[model samples]
Structures are given as structure tokens and as C-alpha cells.
Target chain A: MALFGSLFCRLVLGLVIAFLFLPILIVLTVSFSSSAVFAFPPPGFSLRWYASLGKADSMLQAVWLSTQIAALSTAISLVLGTLCAIAITRGMIPGAKAVATFMASPLMLPGLVLGIAFLQAARDFGLRDTYSTLLIAHVVITMPFIMRTVLASLSLFDFAMVDAARMLGRSYPAALWTVLVPNILPGFVSGGLFAFIASFDNYPVSIFLVDVRTKTLPIQLLNQVEMSPDPTVAAISALLILGTIAALIVCDRLVGLKRMASI
Target chain B: MTLARDDLAVMPAAAPARWTFDAKALIAVPGLVFMALAFAVPVLMLVGDSFVDRDGFSLAGYRKVLGDPYYIGIIGNSLQLACITTAVCLAVGYPAAWALARIRGAWQVILFALIFLPLTVSIVVKTFGLTIMMRRDGIINFLLVNLGFIERPMRLVFTEFSLYFGMVNVFLPFMILPLYSVMRMLDPRLLDASASLGAGPVHTFLRVTLPLTMPGIIAGGTLVFSISVAAYVTPGLLVGDRFMTMSQVMAKAYLNIRDFQLGASMAVIMLVISAALILASSYLVRTPGGERR
Candidate 1:
């Protein structure tokens, strides 16, 4: 009976994994097809679509814009989120738990709601600049990721080392800079990486904020798919998959995947 | 004696003054202010806008949304879809999560990575992949035809099935991760104890394991349900003009029609529903388990 039970569990796990991976595998396969159309099981294979990526100027510009917003927002959120996390974890404020929950609440809220709210707020406040509006909205989107990971890291951290540094003649600021920062560096790297990716690939929230000349990569790619329905979008998907894998590897090296998942 | 007393008073004053900086609180101010201005205020304004219009404070927006069967039906459909998607995720994810919790070592790492990979990639990319597969001449139809199941390609792209399939693919990880986290921390001794008492595996699971893991189930369910309800990209891309979710409608209200009041009202509804569901689930988890560690 136990053997049979175990076998059933294994079968379920296997099938679920296949379901999760099959679409991505199909995309990868389709990216290398020689055909211009989206036919499965292409007649032959070639890298021509990837080479043709250069002709898509808007897609390239979207990529650059997305990278800039992601990098900037991640950097901003890292510093702000880390400070807030420290305050919460160290019990320096009353109602820290409530604050922490509020900070991370965006993760649970739907991006579409946030998107419309930001649009309304931007219009109401007379914030006409699309780039700044996008950046601000993305900061809200990315802060929760940074706060969660940083808060988790800080909870595991021992602040006695900072006090020790202080007692050893360092100023309080100097102590935190020298001791606390190094210990939580893994959290920063992982948190920042997640934040960057969250902003980079964000679609729902970004779809509303983007203007005629300021489309993000996901929106741009969606537009391309709607317009062309060709291998060019497949090629972009392949590259993004590659980029995500690279980021995961770096995250694993810095902080084990187990820790990342737990957060 | 007088001199010594003055020195003691001065020392107390110096100590309080030195401790007044509150470095931590000072550090937190910037982030708190930012969230308040950017996130909290915007959402509040959205809710506030729902109750007002050009004629001043009114329920016109809410009335329009609730009174009209079209909008009412869309909300009903969104809820129904979310319910079905959550149920499917829980049914399939429970076993998979259990298996993940039981395993260890390299296989665990690889399987977890496999689940996590799609999550990290763009949802557009994943949905696009599904679009390709579900197309008339896509792999699924091609296989079905070649294998003699059908004489020709069938229309599968813009169907409810494809929408559900796309959503389930996108959200399964959310369900599995939460459940797995809880299951991993479950103590093994309780199962052993139940077995020693001659309880069958089924009985043990129903009486002990299931109750204990209810928190995980609630958490995962809430996550899946809320996300599924508010989903726009998958439904938009997959179904296109065939169906309209509240989110897609809300997007159109804001972007195309320039109806901020209607859009804000819809956005407010989604937020309130999501918040209520989360609170209800958390309450359930808390009351039954009484705060499980």
C-alpha cells in the first residue's frame, strides 16, 4: 500500500512538472525554427530570427527603457527597503508589524488595480511625465520584494556584532556600515535581483503607465505578438528565458535557492 | 556633597540627550513617507473617486457597475473563473506540494527550480507560448489530427479552456510554494504516533495532517483565487474579444474610454474583494490552528 501511495505521488509530481515546463520548452523550440510563421515542428532550424532582432528598433528601445527603470527602481528600493526592514526587525518602532505588513501588502494586491490607481493619482496630481510616473509606480511594485527578503535576512541576523563594533571604538553609523551591511549583503543581492526582475518584466501595472513613446519590454513584446505573430517574439522569449536563468544562477551562488524560495 | 549631586543630575541629562537620536526610526522615515505618498495615497484616491463624480459625491459609478447586468455578469464570471482556477490549483498542487515536501537533495533542488523557472519568466512570454500551442495549426491540434483524433484543425485559441489553462500554468507555482513551505515544517512524529496507534494512512491524513496544514491550504488558496480574479493579460490575450473580465473592462474604462470614475470604481471593488478574502482566510487559519509555528 505504501509503495502504491508513493508511486501515485511521484506520478502527480512528474505530470505537474511537465505541465509547468512544456510551454517554455515549446517557446524555446519555436525560437529556433526557420519558418516565419508560428508553426510547431518547423521544417528546419536556424538562428535567423535572432539576427533579425536588430531590425526591431522599438523592441530594442523598450528593452533599454525597461533595463533603466528596473535598475533605478531596484537601487532605490534596496536602500529604502533595507532601512525600513532594519527598523522593523530591530523593534525600533511601535506597530512595526503593521508597518511591515503594509509595506508588503502590494504583493497581494492585483497589479491591474494598482495600475489604474496610479493612473488616476497621476492625473489628479498633475504628474504629466510618463517616465517619472513609471518609475514611481515601479518603486511601489518593487519595494515589497526588497522589504520581504531584507526583513527575513535581518531577522536571522544578530545585531550584537554592531554593538560590538561600537564598543570597539567605532561610531554607531560606522558600526552599522562595517558590520551590519556585510552580514545582510546576501539579502541585498537577492532582494535587489528579485526587485529588478519584478520591475523588468512587469506588464499589468506598466501597461497603463506607458505612453506612445515609452513602452516597456513586456508591452512592446505583446504589441509585436499581436502585429506580427512571428518568430521575432519567440526569439525575445528565448533571450528572456536565458536572462532569467542567469539571474537565478547568480542568486543561487549568493544565497542558496532554498533560502530564496523561503523568502 | 552639593557638587557631587550636581554632577549626578548633569550625567542623567547627558544620557537622555545622547539617546534621543533614534537612528532606526530616522532611517525608516524615507520609505514610510514614500509608500504613504505613492502607494497608500493613490489607492485611497482611487477609492475616494469611486464615490464621487462631476456632479459631486454620488454612487453613480457603483450603481452603474452593480445595476447593469453586463458589469454584474462580468464580476460573476470573474468570481466563477477564480473559484474554478483555485480549486484546480489546490487539487493538483496539494499532491505535488506533498511530494516536494517529502523529497530532499538534488532531485528536490531540480524540481523546485523547474517550478520556479516559469514564475521568474515574463507572464507574456508564457501566455504567448500557450497561444502558439493552442493555435489552429499549433502543436496540440497538429498532434490531435496526426494521431487520427480529428480530420482537421479545430478552433482552440480563444476559448474558456485556453484561458483556464493559461491561468493555471501561471498560478500553480503560487499555490505549490506556500503549501510546500508549510508541509516541509510538519513534524514526522505525529504520523508515526498515529501509525503506532493502528490508524490507517487515510485516517491519519484526514484527522491530523490535513488539519495541521490548513494554514498552508488557506494561504495558497487565497493567493491563487485573488490572482486569478484580477488576471488581465492571460484572459485578454487568450480570449481577446470573446470574453471580458472585470480587469479587462477596467483597463478599457481607464485607457480607451477615458472613464476614470468607472475604472476607479472597478479597481476599488477588486481591491476590497481581494482584501476581504485574504482577511477571511487568515482569520480561518488563525482560529483553527491558534497560531501554528
Candidate 2:
């Protein structure tokens, strides 16, 4: 009976893992298919879809826009989140625990609600720039991710090393760079990676903030799926899969995937 | 001599170098100020808008959203979708998380990647992938027919099945990650001790494992529920306009209908529901001690 129970557990685990990977594998296979229309099996294999990605003018624009926003937001969140994380971990605030929770509270809110709020806020302020609105909303979207990992890393960090370095004639900023930064580098790398991905893939918030010209990639890709059924999306998705794999490889080397996942 | 109670509570005995304020605490100010401007103020404005119209203060928006059956039905659909998705995630995610925690080495890496890789990919891509896979002539239909489960291809896309399937597929990681984290921290020796005490495996699980992991279950369940309740993309792509979720209705209100009052009320409703879930879950997670933030 125990053996059977363990077997049942293993069987369920195997099936769930397969279920998770199935759609991704299908997307990859469909991306490489020579057939234009989606089908179970392709008539032949070709790089036609990938080749067609160049002529996708708006899609490329959207990709560039998403990359910029994601990069910018991740950068901003890392600096600000790390400092706030420092304050929380060092007991520098009166309600440190509550402050940490508040910093991460944006993650608890639904994206559509945030989107609506930002929309009304923008209107009230007469802030008509789509780009600026998207960027600002994305900063909020990315901050919690950075805060979570950075706080985890900071709590495990030893600040005495910085104080020791300061005693050794190093300046405060210099001590922070030398002693503090390297110890928590893994958190920064992993947090920044996750934050970048969060901003990159955001849809609900970006949906409200985007104008026709400023549509992010997820919004644009969704529009394509609605307007036209084609492999160009598959081509883009395939490239993104490859990009994600490259990122995973980098993160695994720097911080290890297991550690990153734990955070 | 005369220490303020709030200040005393804030300062732990180990870190008692404070009376006015810790100058280092100012490091958090920029981020706090940013959140106030970007997050807090806007959400407050949304709440304010829900209670007002163009000319003056009004409850017309709430009357429309709360009174109309169509709107109420949409609210019901969102809640139902969220509940089912959260329940499914917890069910599937528990064993998966347990297995992940217990597994080792290469297979563990492989399994973890399978979950984490999809998470790294955009939800749009994942949902889009599901749509393609659920097409009449897609692999799912092909497998179903070939495996003798069905006779012919069915229109699987734009259906409730696809919506739930796509939602679970998208949000399952959020569920699994929390459970896995908690399970990793659980001591396997406790299970061994339970068995040594002559407890049956079922009894050991129920009395020992389940109680310990309740926090994880609550956290993962609430995480999935709150987020999925407000999900716009997965349902939008998988089911389109065939199903009207609160988010879809909210989107239409803002973008197409030009009804900020209606949209703000809907957003406020979502906000209140999610806030209650988050608060309840955290409250439930509190230990016999003060809390575990």
C-alpha cells in the first residue's frame, strides 16, 4: 500500500510536469513548422516564420519598446528597492516589518485595478504622455519583485563588514561597493532578472497605459492573435524562448537556478 | 524615562539606538515617496472616482454595477473563475511541490526547469500557446481523437475549459513556488518521527504534515485567487468576448464605454475583494507568537 501510494504521488508529479511543458513545446514545434496555419503536424520544416519576423514592423517596434521599458524599470527598481531593503534589514525604520510589507504590497493588488487607478490618476494630473505613463506604471510593477529578493538577500547579509571596511580607511560609499555589493550580488542578479521579465511580460497594466503607437510587446502580440492568425507570433515567441534560455543559463552560472527559485 | 509605547514597540531591545528617528531610515524615503505618488495616490483617486460623477457626488456607478444582473453575473463569473483556478492550483500544486522538495539531483533540475522556464516566458506567449494547442486541428484534439477519447476534433478554443485550463496553466507556478518554498523548509525528520511513533501514514500526514503546511496552502491559495480574479489576458485570449470577467467588463468600461465612474467602481470592488483575501490569509498565517513577517 505504501509503495502504491508513493507510485501514485510520482505519477501525479510526472503528469503535472508534462502538462506544464506541453504548451511550450507545442509553441516551439509550431514556430518551426513550414505551414503558415497552425496544425498538429507540419507538412515540412522551414525557417520561414523566423525569416518573416524582419518585416513585422510594428512587432519589432513593440519588442524594442518592451525591452527599453523593462530595462529602464528594472534598473530603477534595483537601485531604489535595494536602498529600501537596506533600511528595512538594518532596522533603520520605526515599523521596519510593516514597511517591508508595504513595499511589496503592490504585488498583492490585481493588475487591472492598478491599471484603472493609474489611468484615472494620469487623467487627473493631465499627464497625456503614453510613454511616461507606461514607464511609471512599470516601475511600480517591477519594484515588488526587486524588493522581495533584495530583502531576502539583505536579511541574510552582514553589515558589520561594511563597518569594518570603513574602519580600514575606506569611505562609506566605497565600503558599500566593496563589502556590501559583492555579498548580495546574487540577489541583485536574480532580482533584476525576475524584475526585467515581470516588466517585459506585463499585459493588464500596460493595456490601459498604451496608445496605438506605444503598445508593449505583450499587448501587440495579443492584438496580432486577435487580428490575424499567423506564425509571425510563433517566430517571436521562439526567439523569446531562446532569450529566456540564455538568461537562465547566465543566472544558473551566476546564482544557480535553485537559489534563485528559493528566493 | 518616559518612553512612548509606539516607539518602544518599534525598537527591539537588541537595536535600541533610537529616540527621534534613525537617520539611516531616510534611505527608504525615495521609494516610499515614489509609491505614494505612483501607487497609493492613484488607488485612492480611483476609490474617490467611484463615488462621484461629472457634475457632483453620486452612487450611480455602484447602482449600475451592483443592480444590473448582467454586471452581477460578470462579477459572479470572475469569482467563480478565481475560486476554481485557486482550488485547482492548490490540488495539483501540493503534490508537485512536495515532490519537488523531496526530489534530488538531475531529475530535480529537469523538473524545476519545466516549471520555472514557463514562468519566465511571458503569460501572453503561454496563453497564446494554449490557444494554438486548443484549436480544432491542434495537437490536443489530435491526441484526444487518436487516443480514443473522442471521435473528432471539437472546437476547444473560446470555451470555459480553455479559459480555466489556460488560467491554471498560467497561475499554477505562483501556487507551486510558495508551497515548494515552505516544503523545502519542512524537516523530513518530523515525518520519520511520526512514523516511529506508530502513527499510520495517513494519520501522520493529516496530523503532522497538513497542519505544518497549512500556512503554505493558505498563502499559495490566496496568491492564486487574488491574481486570477483580476486576470485579463489569459481569459481575454483564450475565451475572448464569449466570457465576460470583471476585468473584461472593467476594460470595456474604461476604453470603449468611456465610463470612468463604472470602471472605477468595478476596480474598487476588485480591490476590496482582493484586500480582504490578502488580509485574511496573513491573519490566518499568524503563529501563536506575534506574527511571521
What is candidate 1's TM-score for chain B alone?
0.90
Q: What is the lDDT of residue A67 in candidate 2?
A: 98
lDDT per residue, candidate 1, A31-138, as tens digits?
999998778778789999999999989999999999999999999999888888988988777899999999998888999999988988898899999999999999
CAPRI grade of model 2: medium
Q: Which pairs of residues collide in model 1?
A: none
Candidate 1 local Cα displacement, residue B148, angstroms: 4.3
| Interface CA RMSD, all predictions | 4.5, 5.6
Could you tell me which 10 consecutive residues in candidate 2 chain B have the lowest summed lDDT? B1-10
* Error at B251, model 1, angstroms: 0.0
Question: Which pairs of residues clash in candidate 2, taking residues 3 or more apart in a chain or in different chains?
Answer: none
State how far residue A220 of model 1 sits from its true place (Å). 0.4
Interface CA root-mean-square deviation for model 1: 4.5
Write one digit per residue (lDDT tens) for candidate 2, span A48-92.
Answer: 899999999999999999999999999989888888888888877
**Candidate 2 per-residue lDDT over residues B181-237, each given as its tens digit:** 888888999888998999998998898888888888988998899989999988988
- Could you give candidate 1's per-residue lDDT for residues B133-173 as a string of tens digits? 99887988999999999999999999998988888998999
